[model samples]
Target: MANSPVSPSTNDDSAENAAHGKGRPTPSRAEQEAARKRPLVANTKEERARARAELQARREKARVGMEKGDDRYLPVRDKGPQRRWVRDYVDAGWHLSEWVMPMMVLVIIASLVPNVTVAYWSFLVLWVYIIFAVGNMIFLGVRVKRKAAEKFGAERREKGLGWYAAMRSLQMRFMRLPKPQVKRGQYPE
Candidate 1:
């Protein structure tokens, strides 16, 4: 029994186990390489500074592109040929809504006068002007939509383009973003 080859609790430190690995299977070379890979984001001070500089450069480029109305850098809402056409159409025309804000301001000042008659008349005029402006905007929107459909094809026209054109028309030409590429009376083909 003392000379038996088999033992219940053998503590073998075999050469085979040492070569292959003991507790768990050894990882492949590819797995080891993958495990050593680092994340893309900056991890050190110098890397952080470089990243910030790159970001600023990108932002500047985008800003310039947006001002120039370059499609690549324009916001999603303002992108697409349809929007450009809408802007062009709006820029080519004049609308009464454009003066509504200034007139409203005048009306408000008039309403603040000490005389009750002047204030009451100002209020009445303001309400009438508001109703007229709203109606004018609606008419402008419909006309724009019809023209856009004719020029760009009904299928290609964006849904909210009418409202977009109308709103842009209501704004003073110089104040509109993308800077009203087409001058007044220079309609788009």
Candidate 2:
């Protein structure tokens, strides 16, 4: 009777597709409102546990992606062929900047010594080493810019790319993210 010619049924498409239900009775208005309402803070242990598990899973996925150099998982700063090339270039060769950190530690220790002469000399040597290190870093930055410009396009290059390369070079090879695609002395062409 509902499907009579005088009345159009909503299930007219039933011939082409079967209607599927939630398999549970429809929720009441009060139940819906109650479900919609949640405390400002989750007081339930299950909620906290679920949240922690989700956060851990997200962080783990990101870490693995970062280590693998997966572009989708990488941060905006690290996402690009040019950045990868810079990382590879830096990792391929030992840089003066790498030792600068250890030198800085030594200098700090020497400066803490009771002997004024020792402190003075250590600071002086440190200043000289720092000057050389800065010079070396600048040289490397220029080389990175030039190489990247040649490999990529000069017009397409981003500003401060040289600085990015220089900073990456300062980090110890083993500590680099995306884990050094090139071996020492295997500089990218």
Best candidate, TM-score: 2
Over the stretch 81-121, how does candidate 1's per-residue lDDT look in tens digits?
98988888888888878888888899889978899999898
Give each prediction's root-mean-square deviation over alpha carbons.
8.5, 7.6
Instruction: Show where candidate 1 strays beyond 4 Å.
Output: 1-57
Worst 10 residues of 2 by lDDT: 12-21
For model 2 the local lDDT of residue 112 reads 92
> What are the per-residue Cα lDDT tens digits for candidate 2 across 1-189?
477566655764665454564579889999999999979987999999999999999999989989988999988888888888888888888788878888989989998999999999998998898888888899999999999999889998777778988888788777888777778999998
CA lDDT scores, all candidates in order = 0.84, 0.85
